[model samples]
Target: MILKIGKLFIAAVIFTGISALAVSAFAASGPALFRSEGCIACHTIDGHGGSVGPNLSHIGSQRSLSWIKTQIVTPGAHFASGSTVTINGKSYMAIMPNHKNMPASDVNTIAQYLESLK
Candidate 1:
């Protein structure tokens, strides 16, 4: 009985450690992936990035996680009519380019990060 209890405790500890590591890795990757994927070229996080796209400092407050994910994965599908994205003080009629080629995992990571901004 003692041995079984010890084994269970060890298993729980291992599971917790793995979970923590996974969360840490995703947290680290989210911002890095956003930058490496060139999102900064068009979007701003806190008025510090490019002005080609809309400022995304409060995007999480305006969008849901699933919506953000869909936008990332199939940007054209959502903006077929070519909506206008205002940057700084200028509005440009443009369609967000499709990122369907990006891996699903990376998309999800980015979505999660964006969702956390609120």
Candidate 2:
């Protein structure tokens, strides 16, 4: 009976490990989704991506997750008191087209991922 109990405990541990692995797998894919959505074209996270916008290496520390999500869904909601996104030696409005077509849930995922970028 002791041996059987030990086997059951081992199985439980294995099952928990598998579950944790699955969760991490999903978490790992969050950044992939950001890339797939073309965010890389304008933003750089993790020291790789684009220079059209500011490098978001520490965005998680600078911006709240909720603010990031809202900004993703409706960009230009707030702009700095000075300056704007410069393009090709010219100043342009800080308006980011809202990807309204994207599902809110996906946007939320992206926001969470960006929030974790730091």
Candidate 3:
């Protein structure tokens, strides 16, 4: 019984260490992914980027994390594709591509990063 308990404790410790590493990686990758994933091409943050999509400088202040995730994975859920949507007094076409095939980890990381903007 003591040996089993010891093994279980060791297993738990390893799992915790791995989990911490994963969380750290997730937290660190968001900004990089945002840039590498071509988000900068259409969204502006901190006064940099293109004008194709709505500026995301204060997206976190305006949107929830879950909402951002949904927008990333399935933007059509919020707005019909090819339709015009108004945001912050500006008109924009709902042209953001759907990322349904993107890895969930990337989506979560991006959402968390955007949610932390505020």
Report lDDT per candidate: 0.82, 0.76, 0.92
Better of 2 and 3 by TM-score: 3
- Highest lDDT: give the candidate number: 3
Better of 1 and 3 by lDDT: 3
Quick one: ranking by lDDT, best first? 3, 1, 2
Tens-place lDDT per residue, model 3, 1-118, is: 9999999999999999999999886654877989988999999989989998988988999999999999999999999999999999999999999999988988998999999997
* Model 1 lDDT, residue 22, Cα: 92
lDDT of 3 at 41: 97
**Candidate number of the best TM-score:** 3
Superposition error at 52 for model 2 (Å): 0.8
RMSD of each: 3.6, 5.4, 2.9
lDDT tens readout by residue for model 1, 1-118: 9999999999999999999999886654877888999888888897667866777888888889999999898876665547775545678667567788998889998999999887
- Model 2's alpha-carbon lDDT is 0.76
How many steric overlaps does candidate 2 have? 0
lDDT of 2 at 103: 79
TM-score of each: 0.69, 0.63, 0.78
